[model samples]
Target: MLENTLAATYTPGVNLKHNVAGANWTFLLPRFALDTIVCYGVPGQKALKTLARISNNLVIVAAEASTQTMPPGVRLHSGPATSLPLPARTVDLIYIATRDAQRLIERDGDACDELARVLKADGFIYTEAGVSAGWLSQQSARLGQAVRYWLTPLLGEAQTAVPEVDAATRRYFVENDLFSSSVRLAAIGFGKRRQPAAEAAGDAANAPLRTGGRSGKRRLRQKLRPLAAALQQAAGRVEGQVHLLGKPLARRGVLIGPEVGPGIPQYLANIAAEAGVDLRGWRWGLAARGEYSSRKVLIFLFPPDEQRPSLIVKMVREAGFNARLENEYRALRWLVENGIGDAATLPQPVFSGYHGGLMLVGETIIDGTPFRAADGVETGELAERGLNWLVELATTTANTGVASAETVAAGLEVLLERYIEIYEPGAGERAFLAEQVDAIRRSRQPFPLVFQHGDPGVWNVIVTPDRRTAFLDWEAAEIHGMPLWDLFYYWRSVAIDVSRRQGVQDALAGFERQFLHESPLNATLSLAIRRVCDATGLSAALVRPLFYLCWMHRALKQATLLPRNQLAQSHYHNLLAFCIEHQDAPALAKLLLAGRAEPQVSG
Candidate 1:
């Protein structure tokens, strides 16, 4: 009875496209329809909006609500494109944009039922969707909390004990739906739809989709890649409160900013008094703001002068306090060597959480005298310039199209070697190597742990116009267990350099090539040393199996990482082949042949 009323009362919306007396469906035949039903869920809004603007008889049904109060001249009703609100066999044509089948299933099969009812026996349904942003069909601890959240809300009493709807909401999707068939996780149907009997039964030659439409549609979907990336980048903004401001300072030729962080103004004042610069009488202004995570920053401006323009004050949050300082060319030198350079020694374990700091100082000849003192103290240049140089080289590689692998590897190698130099083991290098190796071998591969920049990619390593390298985003620095861990973590960044051919190989090659061309002997010795060092650390007597297993596990786990890190796939396959060729598991022939999988014994 309801269906009969719906059909009798169905007064077509405004015929804006064909309002003339002579106008008819013949002009729009094969292209236009009496009604255009758009399925909108997840990301279908874009397409729905586009079609609504260009077509005359367009209507949108909210996927979640199953109903809508559309604009004048537009129809609204509950139902999927395959099904309609009118009758059992009414819809002349149906259109469904891409949406998740699992999500639709969670909505109590309304999508499927609507499609089944409204789609005419001889009519057709045009639909599109992809697995790109679809949800999981099942549950697993490894699948993460987001999937669980998405399912929990829509599933309602079906997933729990709320029991409000049908007695079969939960089981309906898994039991009989064509789209879903699992509990913990069954399948992910990104964009699946049912065609009317005619569309489905059409001969291969008469197929409307035979004109390579799938490829074109896929290309259209790929256009969302940038949007996805933008969303990912903005994800961080959602979590934190950020503030920005401008500050002005009294002096020129000053690169003012935080060194250790927000409190540096006190320290800078002391230095100014020592330098006979009466900052007490100088009108220097400071501005500060903070991100919600306790990371406060400061910016400063300077008085314009003939020799130097306005200076900017900066601040950084370190060790729970706002450490403030000025950027002086000379001060920058001091910080680089002592704070950054000295800290670069390999094996010189970071004081765990002490992410490195930077200080800047400038030098200028005041009245025929080269001013060497800041806060009336001396500045060091050797260590600072040296570290700065290495940073420069790494940045250059990153910008010159060297693969991310190569640029980051070079940085990590430099960092590790510097740590080794600074720490200076009291015992022989070999003895020390043996102990560390044995300890590491006995334990599971420690997750990356040495405290270094958490994200050591190109953008974070900011370079100045004057050729100085200043590392930003010290926030992500962390402690991972092995030097190689840093290398491996950095290697993962090659995904950012996807445009390069053989990106991974070429990136790894960058480190080697740079070494060979600039420091051949050092490069050769370093490789030999690392092989011995790592071998000792793992304590796995046979290099082949240990090497292979280590790489294989990393690849397996990383290759399938969420958000689809493509670089891991290439690295995993390449290293898997390498490991297979190198493995000497014959010693464990019994375990392999008998299927008694056990760790291969190592000396």
Candidate 2:
């Protein structure tokens, strides 16, 4: 019977990593023909492969979706650790392989409860118990001596003790009388104790008393409330749709829900259906969750099946930003019409509209992955591609307008005022910024505006395995902006990446020496500048100041909006320092002098 159960439950074809400690489980497989096994947390690939060879049914659950495809018979479930979609008391064995067991338990105590509840009588639980040096001293002498004797040689003379198990976990298991054994680095096992019939009955009898004499009633009421609310919400939505039938829907500002719910998928499916696209076989999974901002941007993926190509559904929700989606939709259409970039490099907009206060955009998924500078691409090659893209964007689009010196100066002052209000800059810093603003105001040369991708960081660009690049996130694209702004911004991102990889001091020092022509990065910058100058007949002198202006603009903008962000603060401070050191630079020097002389601008 055990052999049959093992054969029925063993999963096949799982590949496991060889380095994990739990990979030794293969030797123990002969002892028990387990009926069901669950690999929780991240298990070793080698261990999983060995388990698959022995077990027919294996389930792997984790917080994030697996990047690799699962082999046949192995199932992957993604969700918070606190919840697992499994029947109670059905699992025969549970394996949790993680370095920090206490952290795991603390993060999701309910998961531990679920593990206990699901294990059948006599079922086993295996985990890593990483205890420190004094850990054994606190335990029973017999167990402590045995563990210390076994582990002492492994610890060596320099290392007198090592972590063996977490105190809280050991107590929980010991108090419950479930701990079976401990050997080497692997904690052996625990079993669920079967409850006696009389004890169970007594507990059942006292349940109502524990709940103030309304156990069943309270349970029933709690369960019914959610169902009632769901039904009412569904009915209201249906009525709202019916009422809007054949009527022009008014454009309402952005609407946002506090949390994402099941209805989101259905709402998106309805939108797809309205656009004559069938998504009946599609399953939605979250692709990305953005940082804290008023805008809630969620990217969801619809994996390709037999009938349709893979699709990406992007939803942007905010309290009052209704026009962002509209802007993106129009920008995409314009890009497609102008053939600004390769067809595959651009998002093919399928359907875009607003629903339930969300700005929804469905586009064909790009088959590429996000580009990383460390991915073996030569620095010059990456810079060339990025610069070429900017050039293409600038040259292909017609000039919208010329932004005058006064307009630029006024904008900088507004941003500076906001920054001062939030950051409370020192007297010297405030005076310096005021002078820089004045210098910008003094420069009267107007730069021609071109359509610009407002945010062009490496993360926003997707690179195919074959080295093809495509840009994403067009919601912030501006129709009228200096072409050099995008180029300088892209350069700033590369510099930041370099700073992150190499020490900040090294990168900043490199920037100081190599910004114009000496550094490799400067070569790319020079090439981009030369190309733009050739294309637009703009002088290097005229455009040089614009780069500094662009950096200041970005720094001020980020500082004003995200005052608490240390990274933004660092960038702002760095820019100020750079300006102070290089005050001889024409545009920046003028601005600094002006800032020092000008009266403080009011909020």
Per-model TM-score, in order, reads 0.25, 0.49
lDDT of 1 by residue, 1-603 (tens): 011111121111211111111111111112222343433342233234334433465545544553333444555544553454466655544444335543453354555566546544444343222222232222111122111110111211111111112113222211211111012110132221111010111111111111124655544433443444355335323211110010111011111111211122344444444646433322222222211212222222223222221233333322222221221232234334444433222111111111113232222211111111112111223213323343332222222122222232333333323323333323443243333334334433211122233233333333333333333333323222122332333322322222122232232233223222333322332343244334323222222222323333333322222112222223433433432433343422211122112254433
lDDT of 2 by residue, 1-603 (tens): 011111221111111111111233222111224567777765656456545544567888776766655657887777755666677777756666554543564355476566656665545544333433332232222111211101111111110111122223223222322222111211111111111111110111101112135556544543453455455445444433432331222111111111112222445666777888777644333321211222334434444342223676665433244455666777888878877765577887888766545477888766665666326544546545866888778766635245565675666576566556655667887787787667656654444457788777666776766676677877667766555778766775565455434533232443454452245665566666666655654434445456555655554434322224232223444654565567575433332222112233222
Cα deviation of 236 in candidate 2 (Å)? 42
Candidate 1's C-alpha runs over 4 A off are 1-298, 301-451, 464-470, 478-482, 498-603
Worst 10 residues of 1 by lDDT: 196-205
Residue 47 miss distance in model 2 (angstroms): 37
Global CA lDDT computed for model 1: 0.28
- Judged by TM-score, which candidate is best? 2
